[model samples]
Target: MYIKRSIFSDSFIRLLAVFLGGAIGSLARAAIVIPLAINPLISVFLCNITGSVLYIFAARICGKNLKLVKDFAATGFCGGLTTFSTVCKDGAVSIQDGEFLLSFAIFALNLLFCVASIHIIDSLADKFGKASK
Candidate 1:
């Protein structure tokens, strides 16, 4: 029998970093978002956008895997904090249980909403930055 290791865990240290980083990210998310029950769609929208920006910065800072900080920060923290797997699982279940159209619609809705939120946020921020300068 063979056991497959996590992508980050091809080696022991990498695995440890991923676990620790993910724990930190998950904990931070719980701390920040648990206080209020916001709309699920809004929460997902914001989180996905936030996670994407963080990922861009993290990979840049990581620089050829030499910086563990980026990997841990993005993969562990942002990845853990985001709800992508939940979306995938829900979508899959919806489709498998014979609601293929509904599942597809939900998936499309998520993608559309998330992308729109990102655009809105960036556009506003850019405007704000210009105004401040």
Candidate 2:
């Protein structure tokens, strides 16, 4: 006897959620980064900051109830939107170009801002949760 399983399995659905979210996130990143007539590093910084904020909001709102939303928004979307590799590459290139200070600033500012945004969003979510309760 042969048993057939449906194509739309649980894993497949999750994969699809991530894929769709990633595509949307990537497009959103491009939309923000492409039009800016500024330094590439600055554009990338904006993307990372925005992604961090969105990731926090998604995590807070989705929590444990919305597994797919968390996976899609936080994991897939934010992962696609933020570019750690780009930051590293840019910093490396700056160092190679004898712009040591610029390289240092790039790494420092991104780390500071992203972490701060996460913390701020988490705090706000906590307050909002308490108030709504």
Candidate 3:
């Protein structure tokens, strides 16, 4: 006997995975970031840079077959943990507060750090993966 599951069942399960992971990630972010809100830029920077590193590591570790883990950790958690909206809002706030240098610095730092973290983590993962096999 063959049993068939509906398409929506898989999607629903994936969505649930993402939702749970996102919730946890958001909470983790709030715990770290809110305390550091004395300097909003620092909070955003940490979230973004850490999230990029985490996503890269998670993707490398999980590989292609673990769709649930990849979606949960990389897509959902990292997406929730690292926020584009908050970064934009922080930049806007800085501009409104007339901290032009800080604003530009924030933008530049986020861009540079996130890019560098991804590249570095990816390279390390590749090296480690080959050595492991």
Candidate 4:
């Protein structure tokens, strides 16, 4: 006997969810980054911070059973919105330009803010969750 696989298989659906979410997230990032006259590093930093906060919010809101939401929001959207490669490139470029302090500051601040935003959002979500119950 031969088995036929449906087009909307679980894995396929999950992949589609991620792909759609990523496309939207990437477009959103570009929309923000492309128009700003500010430093490229600053734009990327803002995106990273925003993405971190969004990921935490999604994780808390989605909970354990909402795998699609988690995958789309936290994994796909956040991953697309935040550009670690750009951050690394910025740091490298700064270093090459002999701006050692600037490179260090960019790396340090990004790390600090992203981690802090995650904790702050998670804490706020916990508090709100308790208050709502």
lDDT against the true structure, each candidate: 0.70, 0.92, 0.87, 0.89
lDDT (tens digit, per residue) of candidate 4 on 31-93:
889999988788999999999999888888888989998999988999899988998999999
Ranking of candidates on TM-score, top first: 2, 4, 3, 1
CA shift of 78, model 4, Å: 1.2
Candidate 4 lDDT score relative to the true structure: 0.89
Q: List the residue pairs that clash in candidate 2.
A: none
Model 2, poorest ten-residue lDDT window?
1-10
Q: What would the per-residue lDDT of candidate 3 be over residues 5-103, giving only the tens digit for each residue?
A: 666788899999999889988998898877764676687788898899999988888899899999999998998899888888888998999999988
Number of colliding residue pairs in each model: 0, 0, 0, 0
lDDT of 1 by residue, 20-92 (tens): 8889777766655666488554555556667766765566556686666765887888887777776787678
Q: Per-residue lDDT for 57-112 in model 2, tens only? A: 89888989999999899999998999899999999999999999999999999999
lDDT, model 1, position 17: 75
Report each candidate's C-alpha RMSD, comma-separated, in the order given. Answer: 7.8, 2.4, 2.2, 2.2
Global CA lDDT of candidate 3, please? Answer: 0.87
Angstrom error at residue 117, model 4: 1.3
TM agreement with the true structure for every prediction: 0.58, 0.89, 0.87, 0.89
**lDDT score of model 1?**
0.70
